[model samples]
Target chain A: MDYGDSPEEGAFRDRLRRWLTEDRSWSSASSTDDEYWTRQASWHTALFEAGFFALAWPKKWGGQELHHTFEVIVDEELARAGAPPKPSLGYLIQGISRFGSEELCDRFIPGLISGRDRWRQGFSEPDAGSDLASLQTTAVLDGDEYVIEGHKIWTSYSDVAEWCLLLARTDPDVPKHRGLSVFAIPMNQSGIEQRPLRMINGVSNEFGQVTFDGARVTAENLIGEPGQGWALAMTIVAFERQPAELGYVARYAKTVSELEGDVRSDPDSTRREIAEHIAWAHVQSEMLRLHVCRRLSERLDDPDGGVHGSIDKLLMTWTEQSVGQAARHAAGSATSQAGGDSRLGTYLYSRSQSVMGGTSQIQKNIIATRVLGLPSN
Target chain B: MDTRLSSEQQALVDVARRLTERLGPDGVVSLDDDDRVARLDQATTEAGWRRLRDDDGDGRPLASGVEAGIVASALGQALGDTALFGPLLAADLLRRVGIDAPGAFTVALVPELSSLAVADAGRLPAAVAVDALGATSALALLPDDGGFALAAVPIAGTERSFDLTRWVSSIPAGTELEEIAGSRTLTGDDILEVEAFALSLASADLVGIMRGALELTVDYAKSRQQFETPIGAFQAVQHLLAEAKTLLEGSISVSQHASWAVDALDAGEAREAAAVAKAYCARAAIEVCEVAVQVHGGYGNTWECMAHVYLRRALLSVSLFGDDGVQLAFLAARRMGV
Candidate 1:
C-alpha cells in the first residue's frame, strides 16, 4: 500500500547513490568504436567487481541474493545518477541459472557475470520476426556437437558481443513451437558472419545481421532439452520485458520535467499540442512506475501472474514517442535551422520503441486474446 | 506498493455488490418516474450508502476514496442510475469540510439545463449545474481565486432531465437564490484535493458502468445465437467485446490508481493522477457502452435494454465536472506550468 522505500531500502539506495556519485570512471567519451566497446566492457566488469551486477539472482550465482525490489531500486538510482546502462547479459545468466545444467552454469555463469563473455540475442530472423516460432534456423546434432546454420536479423550488440543465446529448429517435423531448441554459441567461430544493420534513426551498427554458417555449438551449450526453445525463448522474452528498475521512472520524470521547462519557455504556435504530449508523457510515466511496483508485488504473490509486459511495452513506446515528439515540436525552427537541436534525433529514435521489444499491433493482439479471454483467430 | 484491495475493503465491496443486486438491472428503467426515484432514494438511505464518505470522530472518513469508489463501482455494475452520484458526491464534499449532509444531497458546479433535459452550462458565465434529486439541500461551489467559495443552497425548482433517474434543476442568480449562512469553504490545497476526489469518484462510477456493460454484452453474446451458432463464437462479436474489455481494464487501472493516490499521496500528485483517470475514463465509458449496444444487435437500441441507459448515464457523467477534452486540457495546463 505504501510507495515510499522501506528504511533498509532507503539506506541501500543512499549507499548506491553515494558510490555512483563518487565514481570517476564514467567521464570521458571514447573516440572510436573499439574504444567505446572496450570501455563498456570495462565498465561492466567494474560494476561486477563492485558487487553491483546481480541483485535478484541467487548467492550461488554471483548475485547479491537480494529481493527483486532492490533491483528496481538499483535501476532507479542508476537512472537518477545518469550512470551507464548494465550490459545485456541478464538473458544469459537467467537462461543458464533457470534452465541450464549445473555444468553449464558453473562453466559460463561466472564468465558472463564478470564481463569476460558478452552475449547477444539470436532469435528473430527475416522470416521469423513476430512469428518467431517459424524461424528457419537449424541446429543439427553431430556426435558431441550441434552445427548451427541460419541468419539472425535485428541482433543487437553482436559486434560487441562474444557469444549469443541462439534459437534454432532441431526437429522440424513437429509443430513449429515444439520443434525448436535453444543453444549458447560462440560468435567468434568460423563461418559466423555479422553485418551491421542501419536503423531508421540513422544509427548504424547498433543492430546487426548474423549469419551462422556451420557454426559449431557443443552439446553442453544446449540450455534445455531438445524441442524446448520456444518455452525458453518465452522465458527470456519475459525477462527482457521486465522494467530495467534503474531509474526508468526517474528517467521519464526527468524527461517530463525538461519537456515542461521547454514548453514553458517556448513561444510556439502549437502550444496546446506540445502541452498535450507533455501531459500524456507525465501520465504514462507515472503509470509505468505504478505498474512496475504492482508487477513486483504480483510476482511476490503469484510467480506466474498473467503477463502484462506487453502492456508495459505498449505504454513505454507510447511515452517515448510522445515525449520525444513534444520535445521536437517545442524545439521549433531549431530543428530545420542550422545546428538544430537533438530533439529531432530523439523523436526519430523513439519511433523504434514499438518496433523493438514487440510491435504495438502484437501487443494489442496479446491484450485482446490473452488478457481479455477473447477467441483468437 | 500493493494494488490489491485489503480484506476489509473486499468485504465492503461484497456488501455493496449485494445491495446493488437487490436494486436489480431494471432499477434504472424506472428512475425517470418520481415514485421510483423516491423509492430508490429511500432504499439507499436505509442501507446507509450515502453515509459511506462521512467521518468517524477521528476526522477520518468511514470509507476512504477506495471504499467509496468500490461502492460506486458496485452501483454502476448493477446498472444503477445517475441519481446516486449527486448524493455520494455531495456527502463526500460535506464530510471533508465537516459539514453534515443528509442521506441524499447534490453538489452544484455547473449552470442551467437544455430542452432534452441535459445540463448545458457551457455558454453560461458561471460554473454551476443543478441536480436537486432526492436532496433536502445542494452545495454550490464558486471558483474563488484558485480555490472554492462554497454555499449551501436550498432546492428552489426542478427541471426535467433527459436522464430521468437524475432530477435536474437550475439555481437562481444574484439576489434571488439565498446562500445559506455559515456555509463551509475549501481553499488552496484542499480545493485541489476535493476536485481530484470528485474526478476519482465519478470515474469509479464510469469504471463500474463499463464493467457492467461489457459483462452484460459478453453474457448476451454467449446465449444469443445467429445463423445457428451463438454470437459469442463469432470473431467480430468477440473482438468487439474484447476491445471493450481492454478499455474497461485500462480505465479501471487508471481510476483505481487515482483513488489510491487521493487517499495515499500528496495533493499535487493526487490531482495529476485524478486528471489522468478523468481524461481516460470520461471517453472510455462512452466507447464501452456504445460497443455494448453494438454487440447486443437490435436489442441494444431498444429503451427496454440496459445498454441505452448505460450510454445515457455515461454521456451525462462525461461532463459532470469536466469531459475528456476538458480534463486533458486541464492536465496540459498543469504540465505547461500555466
Candidate 2:
C-alpha cells in the first residue's frame, strides 16, 4: 500500500534530475519542433548512453534489464524535465525485440536503441480507423520484396521517421483478419510520399497523410507470419494504450500543478470559475493516475492480466480532455483572443485524444465485450 | 510501492465479507428494523470487531488503520444490516483523543458530521442532530467550563434519516452526560486525525456500495431480455453498465490508497488524501447508483429492486461529511495554501 518511491528509486530520480540539469541540450529539445526528430533522437541517445532507455528490455539488446520501476521512474523524470516525448520509441523497440526475426533484430534494434533512426506506426487509415484489420493497404508479394501501395492517415511523425511499421493486406480474398501482413518499409524509398497534416493545434505534429505507391520492402523486412499481422498490431497498440501512454502520471501531475498555479494567480472575478475547473481537473487526474498505477502493478505481478487496457485508454482520454478544457477555462476570453498562448490550440489538439489510439466509443465497446464479458451484438 | 493486500489483511477482508453475507439483505429480513440492527451489532461486537482500534494487553493498537480499512471496505461493499461504523469510528476517535468508553456509540462536532454552537455553559445538555444509528449514545463537543469538552450523551429520540440503514438521533435537553477520560481542549491535529479516519472509511464504504450496485445491475442485464436477446447484448445498455464498472474500479483504486494513507502518512498528508478519496468516491458512488438504476430500466426504480437502497445510502454518505463540493473546496483551498 506504500505508494512512495523506494529508496533506490528516489536516488535514481535525483541522479536523473542532476543529469538533466547538467545537459544543456534538453533545455531546448522541446522548443525546437522544426528539428523534432533530430533533437529528440539525440536526447534519446543521451538517455540510452546514460543507461535509462529500454529499461525493461534484455541487457543484450542495449538495455539495462532493470525492472519496470526504472522505466516508470524515467517516464516521471522525463515529464518533470519537460523533455520531448520519443513517441514511437516504445513501439519500435518492443515490437522488434519481441516479434522480429533475428537478423531483423540485429539490423534495426541497435539503431533504434541508439536513437540513430525512428519509426512511424502506419496502422490507421481513412476507411479502417478502429476496424484496423480492414486496412486497404496492400503489400503484394514480389520477387524477394513486397510492393506496398496504400494511404495511411494520421501517421504520426511519418516525415521524420526513417522506417514505418506498416500493416497491409496481402491476401484480400481471405478474411480480413487472416489476410493481413506487417512490413518494415523504408520511408525514404522512391514511391513513398508524406504530406504533413497541420494539427488542430496549428503545429505539425509530424502527422502525415502518407501515400505508399509501389514502395518496395525486402523479404527480410516482414515481421512474424503473414497472417499474424493482426495479432502483431494488437500487441504494439496494447503497449501504446497501457499506462505507459499516460507517461506514468507524472506528466498529468505537472499539467495539473500548472493549471492550479494559473487559477491561483488569476484575479477574483475569474477565480471561482477557474477554481472549479482546476478542482475537477485535479481530482480526475489523481483518479486516473491511481487507477493506472494499480493496473501497472497488477501487470507487473501477472503479465497475462492484459485485457483491462481499455480502462486505461478510456481514463487517459477523459483526463487529457478534462485537463485541456480546464486549461481553456482558466484562460476564459483570452482563449479566443489571438496571440495570447497556445492553450486554446492545445485544447483543440486534445480532441484527438479520443480519436487516435481508438475512439472513446470503441474503447467502451471493448470494455463491454472483452473486459466485462457482455454479450456482443 | 506494493499495492496488494497482505495475507492477514486478506483474511480480515474475507471474514468481514463473510460477516456481511451472513447479515446482508440475503441474510436479514429488514435492515431498517431496530431489533435486527441491535442483534447484528451485538453479534459483531461479540466477534471482537468493535474494538479493532482499542489497545491490546500489550498496550498496542489491536488493528492498524490498514487492517481497519480492509474490514470497513468489506463491510461497506456488503453494506449489510449491521451497525458497525458508529462503534468502529467511536473506538478510533476515543483512542486518538485518549478517551475510554464501554459501549458502541457514534460521535458529533466534527466538521463533516455535525458542529456545535456554544450556549449557556453548565452541566445542562442541549439537543443536536447527530448522524448515527443504533448506538447507545453519541460523543459530542459541548462548551463546558469556558472551553470545549467531549461528552458521551444519551440519545433521547431517533429520527428517520436519508440513509435508511442509519438513524439520526436527537439529544434532549438536561440529559445525563458522562465526559470521557482525559477529554479536554481539542487541538487542530486532533480534528485532522478524526477527519482522516471519517473520510477514508466513508470513501471505502462508497466504493463498496458502488461495486455492489454495479454487480447487481450487470447480473440483471445478463438475465433480462428484450427483442429476443439479453439486454446486455445491446451496446446502449452495455455501455451504461461498462461506465458504471469503470467508475467503481477507479473509485476502489483511489479509496484503497486513501485508506493506506490514513494508516501510514502524516496527519496533513492523510487529511488531504482522505479528502481526495471522499470527493471522488462521493461523486462516483452517486453516479454508479443512478446509472445502475437506469440500466435496470423500470424494475430498478421499484423499492423491491434494491437499487434505491444503494442510491439512498450513497446520497446519505455523499453529504454526511460534506459532499464533493465541500471536499473539493477544501482540497483546492489547501492547494492554494489559503
Candidate 3:
C-alpha cells in the first residue's frame, strides 16, 4: 500500500504548483459578491486554458484524460495558493458524458469544459428539495420542442449560467421517479426568470431561485430517454457527492490554517480548550483528506459507482462542521462583531454544509437503506 | 497512490483471521480456557507473525508495516489473547538499534504508559510492560551521550489489566538493565521510526475493534426482535449503525495510510501521519464501541455480551501510547506551534 504520490503524479503536482505560483492573474481581489463571482469565472477560464480543469474527463472533449488523482492535486494546489475554487461542473459533465448522445455531447461538453458557457443544475424545487423525484416541473412535448415550466430553488450560479440542466416530469400518470426526463434548456430566453437568493453569508450571486415559465428546448437537447432522468440524476448526484472532486480537503486545510492564524494572533486565545478544538479540527481535516485519498485509490482499482457517495457526503459534513466550529471559537467575538470579515462569512456558510447537496438526515437514510440494506419502514 | 492491500498482505489477513476465529476465546467463560490460549499462542509463534518487523540480512524489516498492521487488526477483531504486538514492537526496537536479541520481549512504558520508558544510568525506571503475556523482560531506551541506547529490564511482577485479552506487567524502580553490548547508539530518527510503528499498529487495532464491535451489534440488531419486528428495521437503530459504519470506514482509511506511511515517508512525516491516525481512531473507536453497546441494549452492558470486550480493548489501545488528547496536543505543538 502506497500513500505517497507516484512519480507521474508527483511530476504533475509539481508542474501544477509551478503554474499556480507563476500565474497570479487568476487570484481574486474582489470585495462584492458580484465581483467575486466574476473573478471566479475568470479563474475557471484561466484553469481551463492552463489545461488543469475537467482533468478526469475524456481527452477527446477538452479534458486531460488523467487519473482523478490529478484532479485532487489541482484542488490541493489551488487551495494552497488561495485561488478561486475550480468550477463544480463535474456532475453536469458526468450527466452529459454518460447519458447524452453524440450530438448533445458535441454541442455542450466543450463549452462547459472551456468555461465559455456556464451552467446550473435545476434539481431542487420548493417542494422537492430532498425528495427530488416528486418535482412538480412539467416538460410537455410540443412538436419538435419541449416546453418547460418549473421553479428551481437553490439553483447555484443560475443568474450567470447560459444553460440549465433541468429535470421535469414528462408523464404525469407514471410513478414520480419514472415520469421524469432531463433537458438541456437555454436559460437566456425570455421564458426563464432568475431571481438571486441572498444567502445567510450575504452572498447573492452564489445561489438563485430560477422560475421557468415556458422555456423551450429542441427534442434533440433531451439528455437521455424520456424516462431515464431518475437514473441520470442519481448518476450526477453520485459524482457530486465525491469530496475529492469538490476539493473540500484543500478548502478545509485553508480554513484550518486561517483558524490557526486567528488563535496565534490572540494570546488570550491560547486556552487549552481552544487549542484542543483547533487540534481536533486539524485532525478531522486530515482524516477527511486520507479518507478521500483511499476512496480515490479504490476508484482506480474499480471505477464502479456505488452508495459509498453517501458515506463521503456524511464524512465531509462532519469535517466541515467541525472546522467551522473551531474557526468560530478561534475568531471569538470577531466573527460576529466584524463586518465583511471572511471568517464570519465562512462560519455562516458552514451551517449550510449539512443542508446543501443533500441533507445529513437524507444522506444517513440513504446509507441505512441502500448501503446497509436496512428496511426503509 | 495505491492503498489497497497486496495479495500477500490480504492472505496474511485471511490466515490471521482464520486462526483467531478458530482458536480465539468466544465468550467471557472461554477466557479461562488455558488449552485454547496455548494453541492460539503456538499458532501465532509458528506463523512468525510477531517477527514481521525483525531485521532482514540488511537493516530493513522482513515485511512492511502494512503487513504487520494487517495481523494486528485481525487480532483485535477476534479479541485474540496473545503477545503479537508486544513481541513485534520489541523486535522493532532491537532491529532499529542494530541488536539481534530475540525472545518473548516487549517494550517497557513510562509509569503513565504514554511512551517508551527512558532508562538512566543503566537502571530501569518503574514502568509498565503491555501485552507482556509470556514475556520475561521488556526493552527500554537508555540515554547514551547525546543519543539513545537499547536495554532490557526483567519484569518484576504482573498486574491484571482492564483488557483481559492482554497481559500487563511492571518493572521495579532502579532495576539493573543490561544494555546490548554491540548495539549502536540510535538517533532521534530511530525513536521516531519506532514511535510511528507503534502508533500505526495501535490505530489498526482500534480500527479492527470498532469493526468487530459494530459487526456484533449489527448482527444482534438483525436477529433481536422487538415490537413484532427486528430492531434493525427501525430508522433510529439503522441510523446509529450507519453512522458507526461511516466512522469505521473513515478510521480504516486513515489507519491504512498511517500504516503505509511507516515505511514510505520520512520519519517525522510518518510520525505526524501516525499521530493523526491515532487521534482520529482513538476518538472514533470509543464512539463506535458506545454505539455498539447502545444498539445491543441491556445485553450490551452485561459481561456475557462481546461488545464490552471490544470497549475494554479499545480503552487500552487508546491510552497505550497516547490518547486523542495527547495526540492532539502533540499535533497542535508541532503543526501550529501553539
Candidate 4:
C-alpha cells in the first residue's frame, strides 16, 4: 500500500502550496472576538474564491469535484501556513445536498458555498444533549409555513448565521426518532431570540442559545420527508466525525510542531517530563493523521456512511485532548501568567472535545452496539 | 494513497494464515508438543517465509517490508513457534552489508535487549539472541572506522523466556567472533533502516496479538452466559470489547504506515514512522490484552484460557526493541533535542 500522494494529487498539492505562499492578505491576526470571527469569514471567502474550499463537493455546486485527499491536502497546507482553519460547513453541505430538495439545494447551497450566507445547526437542547432523539421541539404545518418552537442550546454561529437547520418533532404519536423532521428556518425572523453564551475559552460569538418562540418557515424548507430527520442528522454527524474533513489532524500537527519548537528553543530549561509529553503528543498526532488518511482512502471505495465514524470521533478526541495537555505542560508557568498564552485557552477548549460532537461514552456505546454487534438492554 | 493491501499481499496473508492454523499450537498445552512445533518450523522454512528479506542478487530483498510484516502478523495470531523473524532479520543485516546469509541466524542485542549488540575488539560482549530458536549464530556489529563491520557470533546456550512461543539465547562474554568475508562496511543509515524494519515487525506482531486476543474474548463474550444471558449483553463488557477494537484498529493503521514506510520512504523518515507505530502498538496491545483478560473474568487469569498467552507474547514484543517510554524518549531527543 502506497502512502505517498498520487501524481495528480502531488501536482494539485504543489499548486495549492504555491498559491498559499503567494497570498498574504488574509494572514492578519485579529484582536477582538468580533474581529476574529470577521477574519474567519474573510478567510473562508478567500479560500472559496481560490477553489481551496469544499474540494469534495460536486462541480455543479461550485466545487472542483476532486477526491477527498485533495481536501486533506488543503487542510495540511493551510495548517502549515499557519492560516485560520477552513470553514466547518462540510456537514451542513452534506445534509442539505443529500436530503434537501433540488429547489432547496439550488436556493441555499451556492450561497453557503460562497460564504455569502452563514448557517448554524440547531440539534441539541439543555435536556436533549446526548439523547438528541428525545428532543421536544415542535414544528407544526400551518397553511404554507411550519411554525417552529424550540429551545436550542449550543447553537454555534447563530449570531452570524442567517439560517438555522433545525430538528423538531412533526409527528408525536410515533417513536421519538421516527417523529422528527428537519427545517431550514431563517434566523432573522422576529420570533427567534439568540443569546451568545460565553465559552470556556471566553469566546462568546462561537456559541449561542436560541429560543424560537414561533419561528415560521415555508413548507418548501423541509429537508426531507416528515420522518427523515433522524437519518439526515445521523448522516450529518457521521460527516462531522471525519477528522480529515474537519481539519483536526492538521491542527493537531500544528500544535505538536509549536510545542516541539518551544521545547527545542530552551532545552536547558525544559524538563524531561515536558519533553516526553511533547513526544507523546507528537505520536498521537501522527496516529490520528495516519488513521484519518486510511479512513479517507477507504471512503474512496465505500462511500456509505456507517458506524466507523464513531471510531474516528473517539480517536480525534483522544488526539485533541493529548495535544492540549501537552501544550499546557509545555507552556508551564506561562499558561497561568497574566495575558495568558493561547495554550490555556486551547487546554480549556479541549475539555469540550469529548463533550461537544458526541461524548466519549456515547461514541463507545455506538461502537459497542452498532460496530461490534453487542446486544443492548 | 491506498492503505489497503494489494492482491498479492492478501494472498500471502491467506497462505500464512492457512499454514499456521493447520500446524501451529492451539493452546498452552500444545506449545509443548515437540512434534507439532517441529512440523510448523519445517513448514515455514519450506515456504521460504524466512527468506523474504534475503538478497535478490541486487543487494535488495526479494520482498518488501509489507510482505514480511504480513507473515509476522500471521505468525503472531497463531502463536506459531517458528524461527521466522530472527532468521529474516539476520538475512536483512547481511543484505545491508552486501553478503548472503550463510544459514539460519538471528541478531544479537545488548544484555538489555534494547538494541543491536556491538562487538568489541574482535570479540562478542555479553548479549542476548532474541527469537533465536533453531539458529546456529547471531549477527553483531563490529566497529570499523566510521562504519560497522558485520560479524557472526556463535550462540552459547538457550535460556528460558517469558514468552513461550519464542526462544532466547545468550552469547558468552568475550566470545570470539568471525567477520564475514567480502562484506562491505554498513553506514549509520543502514542500521537505522534495519531498526525501522525490526520496529515495524514488532508493531505488526502487537497488532496481531491484539486481534487474536480480542477475537478470542469476543467469541467468549458471545457464548459465555451470565445473569441468565450472554455477558456481551451487558454494557460494561461490551464497552471494554469496543474500546479494545478501537485500539486494535488504530494500531493497524499506524503499523500499516510503518511497514510501508520501511521500504517506501527515506531511512530517517521510516525510522520515525516505525518508532511512532511501535510506541502506539506497544501501549495499545497491553490495554487490549488486559481488556480481553478482564472480559473473560476468572477464566482469563487461568493458564488454560489462552488469554494469558497473548498477553505474554505482547509483553515480549513490547520489550523487543523498546517500550513506549523508550520510544518517546528517543523521539523527544530527535524532534525536540531534549
Best-matching candidate per lDDT: 4
Q: Give the poorly placed runs of model 4, Cα more than 4 Å off.
A: A28-36, A335-339
Using DockQ, rank the candidates from best to worst: 4, 3, 2, 1
Best by DockQ: 4
Comparing 1 with 3 on lDDT, the higher-scoring candidate is: 3
Docking class of 1: acceptable
Candidate 2 positional error at A20, Å: 3.8
lDDT, candidate 3, residue A23?
88
Between candidates 2 and 4, which one is better according to DockQ? 4
* Per-model DockQ against the true two-chain complex: 0.33, 0.60, 0.69, 0.78
B191-217 per-residue lDDT for model 3 (tens digits): 888888999999999998987898788
Which scores greater on lDDT, model 1 or model 4? 4
After superposing candidate 2 on the true structure, give the runs of residues whose Cα lies further than 4 Å from its correct spot.
A28-39, A75-88, A91-94, A245-248, A266-269, B27-29, B32-39, B56-60, B109-131, B142-149, B157-160, B172-178, B183-186
Off by over 4 Å in 3: A28-36, A264-269, A335-340, B157-160
My TM-score estimates for the predictions, one after another, are 0.85, 0.92, 0.97, 0.97
Candidate 2 residue lDDT tens string, A120-213: 8899998998888878999988899999888999887656789888999999899899998888888987998899887766667557899889
On the 0 to 100 scale, the lDDT of residue A275 in model 4 is: 92
> What interface RMSD, in Å and to 1 decimal, does model 4 have?
1.0
lDDT of each: 0.69, 0.73, 0.85, 0.86
lDDT of 2 by residue, B175-232 (tens): 6667766544556665676678777878888988887888788888888999999999
* Candidate 1 chain B worst ten-residue window by lDDT: B114-123
Instruction: Please give the TM-score that candidate 4 achieves against the real structure.
Output: 0.97
